[model samples]
Target: MPHIIIEHSASLDTDFSQLLKSIHQSTIDTNLFDASTIKTRRVAFPQCILGDGKTDFVHVQVHLLAGRTQTQKQHLSESLLNTLRTLLSDSVSLSVHPYDLDPAIYRKN
Candidate 1:
């Protein structure tokens, strides 16, 4: 399974739900996993908490089951980042990070 967790500034007034759908579709297009197995959620922060007050940011963390090649991971990151940039305003800083989930430690029912 691949879970996409997005964190963005609460001040952002973007169409967040559409953004989530685009991300989900991008992952599905890779054909590495079934559409049913892809999950996405977004969290908005009240403040940057660790950055300059005037700066807005959108950060996406993609967690996938282990065994994907490096190329797959990079494409996943790029696809999501491109989607984010297109949907968000130029004032917002964006970033994407891909992580491997350890099957031995991850649990789902």
Candidate 2:
């Protein structure tokens, strides 16, 4: 019942491994659930369709699957957004979406 979805701009020079590690560690440190049970998915878009260059926006969506209390979810969302903002260049715009779902439906045997 715990899953995390993270989406970011493809243009950003991101270290996927490090990001995953950070999320994993944070989830564990929060003591909200079993670290092993945590599930995270990250997607980066190479090219995004923005509104006539009105805003340089990068969409980031994070879904916490299970064992996340309401407060925990809020904290995670904030932490993730802050992390991305710091990691990305100032020229690029960043946006984060907090979502949730059941992992069982997306799990692979």
Candidate 3:
């Protein structure tokens, strides 16, 4: 399972719903996880200070069950970053971080 969370500055203008759909689809294209298990959400911060206080940013964090190869994780992150690059403006600071959940401790009810 993978949970994708997008955190962005509120000033950033974009369609979050469409972004989620595109991200979900990109995850599916990887053939790494079940389509039904992919989850995506967004959070916007109304106030934040960035470099010079003028730059807006979008950060995507992806959490997944452990045990995937490093290459796979990198691929996942890069795929998402590429997707963001296409949907967002070049002026926006974008980043993607892929985190691994320990299989022994991670659980779902």
Candidate 4:
């Protein structure tokens, strides 16, 4: 299972609901995790600061069971960022990171 958390500044506000949908779908498109097993959430900060305030930023963190190879995670990150970039403006900063969660400790209901 994989859970994707999207964090963005308020200044970059656009269609966040649609952005979330696109992210989730892109995660599925990676074929690394089942669409039904994917999870996504977004947090918007109203008073967040970015370097020089030249542009807003969006950071996506993917937490997955500790088993995926580097190549798989890299592909996932690249694909997610590419898809997100399309839904965002050129001035918006974007990044995607993947973290390996300890399968033994990651408990779910």
Off by over 4 Å in 4: none
Note the Cα lDDT for every prediction shown: 0.87, 0.63, 0.89, 0.89
Q: RMSDs, each prediction?
A: 1.6, 3.7, 1.4, 1.2
Tens digit per residue, CA lDDT, model 3, 1-109: 8999999999888888888888878988989899899988889999888884457888899999988999999999899999999999888888999999998999898
2 or 3, greater by lDDT:
3
Point out the higher-scoring one by lDDT: 1 or 3: 3
Residue 41 shift from truth in candidate 1, angstroms: 0.7
What's the count of clashing pairs in each model shown? 0, 6, 0, 0
Judged by TM-score relative to the true structure, which candidate is superior, 2 or 4?
4
TM-score of every prediction relative to native: 0.91, 0.63, 0.92, 0.93
Residue-by-residue lDDT tens digits, candidate 1, 32-108: 88899899999999977545444788899999989999998888889888888888877788899989999999999
Ranking of models by lDDT: 4, 3, 1, 2
The C-alpha stretches of model 3 lying farther than 4 A from their native spots are 52-54
Cα misplacement distance, residue 8 of candidate 2 (Å): 2.3
Q: Supply the global lDDT for candidate 2.
A: 0.63
